[model samples]
Target: MDITQDQTLDITSFFCPMTFVHTRLALDRMTSGEKLVLILNDGDARRNVAASAQALGHVIEADESLPGNRARLVIRK
Candidate 1:
């Protein structure tokens, strides 16, 4: 299914737990099946965020790395 994102969040400046914390909060604020696009920096933010989201059973639609060691992550809540 093609899911259109209902919101976008930038957790690039956030670190570790806060990265996934903010992302999780955003997803919680959204309704079911709604898509959320997140902007996250590479390294721990990237690895932890994906792991955190997946652990919560949120469906990951896309995880594409961009320039400047950043990535665009799409999650379905």
Candidate 2:
């Protein structure tokens, strides 16, 4: 199930370095305790996006499968 009603950042078609890079930049702009909802449609992003977020001192609190191989992730700073 998808989590709606949060700020969403869609990086579906973005590739590797860009995927992680954009996620980081977006997260950086968010305030502490605020949530960031990411919709990643690429396969490579599903493989490593969470790690990138964790490495940046952020916590990927939840991940739920969305339709069409897309994943919905929530991160808290």
Candidate 3:
């Protein structure tokens, strides 16, 4: 299903824990069923953010690769 995001977070300049930290903070501010479009760098940030968000019980609607070494994670809170 296609989800329309309520917010967008660009964490391409952040690393590990901070990446997820910021994403989590953003999710926390939103209500249930709200969508978040998170743009993060590839590698650990991508992997860890997805894992952490799932661990928090949020739904990962989609994960897409960008032109550069980056990815977009679509999450539902």
The candidate that wins on TM-score is 3
Ranking by lDDT: 3, 1, 2
Clashing pairs in 1: none
lDDT of 2: 0.81
> Residue 1 in model 2: shift from native, Å?
6.5
Write one digit per residue (lDDT tens) for candidate 1, span 8-56.
9988888888898899889989998999999999888988888888899
User: Using Cα atoms with residue i matched to residue i, what is each candidate's TM-score against the true structure?
Assistant: 0.92, 0.84, 0.94
- lDDT tens digits, residues 1-77, model 3? 46687999999988888999899899999999999999999888998999999999999999989989999999999
After superposition, candidate 3 runs with Cα above 4 Å error: none
1-77 in candidate 2: lDDT tens per residue?
44432478899988888888888888788888878888897467866898888877888888878988899888887
TM-score-based ranking? 3, 1, 2
What are the lDDT scores of the predictions, listed in order? 0.88, 0.81, 0.92
Model 1 segments more than 4 A misplaced: 1-3
